[model samples]
Target: MALEKYSTVLKMAQEGRYCVPAFNTYNYETIAWAIEVAEEEKRPVIVQLYPGYDFYIPLKVMCDAAKELAAHASVPVCVHLDHSATYEIAFAGLAAGFPSVMIDGSSLSFDENVALTAAVSRAAHALGCEVEAELGHVGSGSNLDDFATGGKFTDPDEAVKFIELTNVDALAVSIGNAHGAYAATPNLQLDLLSKINDAVDIPLVLHGGSDIPDEQIKQAITRGIAKVNIATEYFRAMYKGYSASIAAAPDKDSLFEISQMSKDSVKEFLRGKFNLLKADV
Candidate 1:
């Protein structure tokens, strides 16, 4: 199958009442593992590239690799640019064949965020790509206090207005979730999510999906979270796998063998995630 549009993938997730897993991949191994597991589990997956990783994995390289993988995968797969902090980076991803791009202007003033997101949306849509924008800030996991603060939760009314102004295909909302490994168990604001769902017609997204309770995630999906982003968990899993492989076989001299060990571990981890999200081809 060809690469699917990000909006279309999320729309299916919305209609099916399941949150599609969007995994951040840093290298060829990680990307291959994610796509392989998605195909095996018969689930659609979103392979995303963080702008920071672009320094190591060129935008074009990642896009071309994902396109090639998706082309041959048995399940639907889409390539996305995640947490793109600027219009230039987001545009570069879109131009390089990423069907979905996120312009994260959440740290800016509300008006400024709206303006920037709108600009990116207009440009991306003109090229037949989808735009995702973050409204309230989803902070780092190291700061647990940020999740507890009521101020960080996205206001339903503001979300509705933001979508109206920006014309984005999806909205990433902050509701007691943070990026990276959570310092403690998260208390997701499902009520707040329900209100946001009621106010906005577009698919809703939840970032910082790592380590959140499975039940909490299921509830969020039921409440209208169409996409969940995962990064820390996969990174840790792959690293642990690589480390263990070297420990078990200290004399192994082949780089390809060591890389395969890490990819296998990542694939196993992703299989569980696909099952958790109830992804079925």
Candidate 2:
């Protein structure tokens, strides 16, 4: 497998029982190590970078490293621009060589989201970059109210309409899931997820993959979630690894040694995900 179109990768995944984990990376270490781990596990993976990190690292630099690494890997990798709020941002991502870009208009009215996403889908397709759009609003973990409300969840009928209107490669559904650490254990609306999966033909995405129970994650996969976005947990793995390495080698370790030790943890974390996300069939 090599660097490939995200749409191709995800569409293939939609046919399987497991998802292709999309790991969010803000640094070179994460990207390089992530692909390496994917190679070790022999599983397809998606590498995503949020636009907010552009201030810290240039988008060109990020995309270049991810693409180059994926080109040489033994397993498939898809470079993606995650969560662009507008067309301009989505265009920037495709221009920067991302094979896929997500245009998020979840905060807008249905018609508005349709217009914005449809426009992006048109432009992105022209450039051969696939588009992913969010239907229901996925909110922050701090506000439990975000996931608790029934209206906020994706309506199966509306999901069908949204996909027909936008023609996105994937749909990110809000099903009792939130970003970052959960205020309390969340019971993912698996029933709603099933309805959405039954309603649409495209791959379904589950944001906030972090902190969900393994059984529930498996259930979500069984129900038709093809892409799982894991962010907070991966960052925490890196931090936990590096900090523990430094603490244990206070007198003997250099930055290089600490990073080498840290890769162990990152590798362990990634391996767990790759194994878990491997299709059941």
Q: Which of the numbered candidates is closest to the native, going by highest lDDT?
A: 2
lDDT of 1 by residue, 95-167 (tens): 8889889999999999999999999999999999999999888998888777867677798999999999999
Q: How much lDDT does each candidate structure score?
A: 0.88, 0.89
The TM-score obtained by model 1 is: 0.96
Error of 1 at 257 (Å): 0.7
Regions of model 2 farther than 4 Å from truth: 279-281
In terms of TM-score, the best-performing candidate is 2
* Model 1, residue 25: C-alpha shift (Å): 0.4
